[model samples]
Target chain A: MNPNGQNAETRDGCAAKLDVCGLDLYYADFQALKNIDFRLARHEVAALIGPSGCGKSTFIRVLNRMNDLIPSCRVSGKVMLDGEDIYGAMDVTELRSRVGMVFQKPNPFAMSVFDNVAYGKRMRGLRDKRQLAEVVEVSLTKAALWDEVKDRLKKSALSLSGGQQQRLCIARSIAMQPEIILMDEPTSALDPIATGRIEELIGELKKDYSIIIVTHAMHQASRVSDRTAFFLLGELIEFGDTREVFTNPVDKRTEDYISGRFG
Target chain B: MKKRVFLDGLLYGIMALSLCGVIAVLGYILVYIFRQAAGSLSFGFIFRSAREGGILPMVVTTLYVVVVSIAISLPVGIGTAVFLTEYSGNSSLVRILRVAIETLAGIPSIIYGLFGLLMFCRFLGFGQSIIAGAFTLSIMILPVIIRTTEEALKSVPVSFREGSLSLGTTKSQTIFHVVLPSALGGIVTSAILAIGRVVGESAPVLLTVGLSRNIPRTVFESGRTLTIHLYYLTNEAVNPDDFGIAFATAGTLVMVVVAINTLTKILTRKFKNSQGDAS
Candidate 1:
């Protein structure tokens, strides 16, 4: 974190902002996202909500070029981080380091909890054992998993319950000190108790890092996000302040989606 | 009541018969080899040619073939399997590659021997030598290794890969660090099977390595394997003593392969246990 509480600037002021304009994504002939335009302010929490196959997860993956790993997947237009074109003049390794992601299913690496949290930091060449230990503790604490795992730091991450695994993944991502965290249905695999913990963790995370979460659960969007973007069939139907979008949606699709009429 | 009794009897009888057939055949072979080789079962028979001291060179030659073939085939086979199961796009090209690999695997050993003799021995300037034999063996076992490895790699749940990749790691890292470890036991089994194939081959070794009694110090040198030694012992036994030598060699080869297979089973179980505990 910067001492001034502001992100460092690149050539474009967009580093302080994440910009996606006229973005389209595809898998072979199948269009996944169509002309999706959205932005996330620095240190803000934004949620994307929609029915299954509505392209919410696709949008979050595009932010960090995770979609690029899929063969036959193609993208057009731009996604800028802090005003800088993250797709341009950036190595994928560096881009991924700056923009972290957590999956819908909690995927703690097959290693121990400490190693899982330390993985990202090690990837970025943080080899000092002392520094790695400190980072792992801080990250786990931030993810609200420190107390439960503090004693069994060396235990296999797979031994943890579902919720603990998810939190460990979050800690692993944050240990890299990424500027943005993109989550694709992060809590869908957890039970309500675990879901609540993840929601609480996301709430605290927004104070330091910008987050873009894709969710199918409307209540989760309302409960956690500051801004919500509602998508339908590859298009962004509506995006605005979460409360306004949910209570008084401007688009009928968004209204129908939130009110449970039909999605 | 009558129908149920008949059906139950038929089903149990068929299964028992199948099991009996397998065990009987194996037991017969073991007894025959042991009984036939009794006269030749000595330290001298294991250490030098029957004409000289024992069959040490043949044992060494078999080891050379197994090691070289495994070294050559393991990486290419496992890598191809990984590509097919993990990174392949669901496209016509991948489908074609898979079919081609299957077809290649189905090709007979004799045909593989012919191809090896023509290509590695004659065309590639390797000559009739252990190197040619190794190349032939490598090609012969490629399909077995590849198909087994592909199955192993595919069996690892997608959740494992997703778990690794979602943590900001790349696809390659996930494969190496997670998927491969999970499938290592299966891959090792494939290797053991390949080793068995290479060790048992006679026709390919005959065409490529030739039936020289001299011990090969390098892959490029001509040599005869245990199976080939067994064959000549049967065919050119000029004396009754040589027949005893052939049975002894056969028994020794069987024991070696059985030992290796047993070791593979033990190692695979150990690996599976460790991974289960680790995860």
Candidate 2:
């Protein structure tokens, strides 16, 4: 059992791998996320669930500073990775490498399967052919794709099925050995079978990495996450153990959302 | 409804007629040029220098100008495009640069020739040489290259850029590795189009690189290109012999242009196939 009195099945007693304190984000004059405080423990899967425009995706993007790409987007408040304030102390590149992201669309680069998996390592200047091959093999295996694609590492990544493409994207991120993986609706574009495969992969992945997934499907959040944070109109309506949030939400809005009364 | 149908039929007929007109004009020109040049075009006419025999000097000059101009313009044009698309934040500076490029594109080639005469031939002391002509042609084609490359770069999806950046790759790295390769087909098409424009120009070549008959050994020496050779031969033709040389030069220029267009088509197809495989 964890010494911190948290449920041993859900969370370890280790310090939060990511901590966001009083965070607010804006795109131009419009506020996107307001006064959000969140913590993600090491090796736990925390799912962010909300309607399309409730700032769940925005909140996750802030974790990796991907919002910095927008010219008018601004953030106020601290996003702490490990112990360092990412905006204040960490280089953006360093922050991104440590916190990799898999996007909603399966965005495998226009290259061979092997090259796509090895791209991050190559960017970090790994030149040894053997090391790249090993990383590719291991990452693809972790993504549950190595067996299917092992024979065709030289083939184009685009030729893969949509599910396989998404997994390939996951492998690409994993190859970087990031501490956390932020997935923005990674299975939204896939079939139910593909979604099941990805959900299973996530269950396996949480043992090694802290994962924060933004999901539109309530069932997915309940099925896959240890914890759930629900948002409505840029506000965190409620956050707690996933089972409790679904079965007995403290906030009426959270209950309404999960019950399909209203978004 | 009957009136609308009639109008649609009328528009379709007009469009088909316009398409036929364009094809007919192109076909007529090709047939006429080939018929005129068939008797005069020979191995000796292409191989020997103008003073000794035919348009060898002019062919060599045209090649030098095309190579030098493309070499000078391509890097500068692509760099400007990258800066505008990747670095600029939709600022007024970018707006002004775009306007300037548009203006350059709109200016007549003759004005560029005059500008070359004053700036390169006289002021730069490159007087009536292949280098002066090349410099002028580079300026003439810079806008074409810049505009086409910018469009190509812009066509690369935003998701690709974001994905690369999220992987901790730098902006320049994303552009070079992901964006540029995807846009390669468009870039090559634009470059070949620019080469076609350079080859067909006459006024600019005449003013910047005077009608010298000798084959140039260096860029500083004066030489004549195929277009200028055709122009002078036709202008001075008071006999059948002079007319035959003019027709031969015209045929050669048409062949070069046709070759360039064919190369562009083949390359674009190859690139599209490769991109299909990758994506």
Best by lDDT: 2
Candidate 2 per-residue lDDT over residues A183-239, each given as its tens digit: 999999999999999999999998789899999999999999989999999998888
**How well is each residue in B137-249 modelled by candidate 2, as lDDT tens digits?**
99999999999999999998898888888988888888887888778877887798889899989998999999888999999999999998888788899988778778988
Model 1, span B112-225: residue lDDT tens: 999999999999999999889999999999999999998898888877776566555677877887889878878988998899899998998899999878778899998989
TM-score of the second chain for every model: 0.90, 0.89
Where model 2 places Cα greater than 4 Å from the true spot, the runs are A1-14, B1-21, B261-279
DockQ of 2: 0.48
* Regions more than 4 Å wrong, model 1: A1-16, A27-31, A112-114, A125-130, A146-156, B1-28, B31-53, B82-97, B122-126, B156-174, B236-247, B261-279
Docking class of 2: acceptable
Which portion of correct inter-chain contacts appears in model 1? Answer: 0.28
For model 1 chain B, where is the 10-residue window of minimal lDDT?
B270-279
Q: Give native contacts recovered, as a fraction, per prediction.
A: 0.28, 0.52
TM-score for the A-chain in each candidate structure: 0.93, 0.96
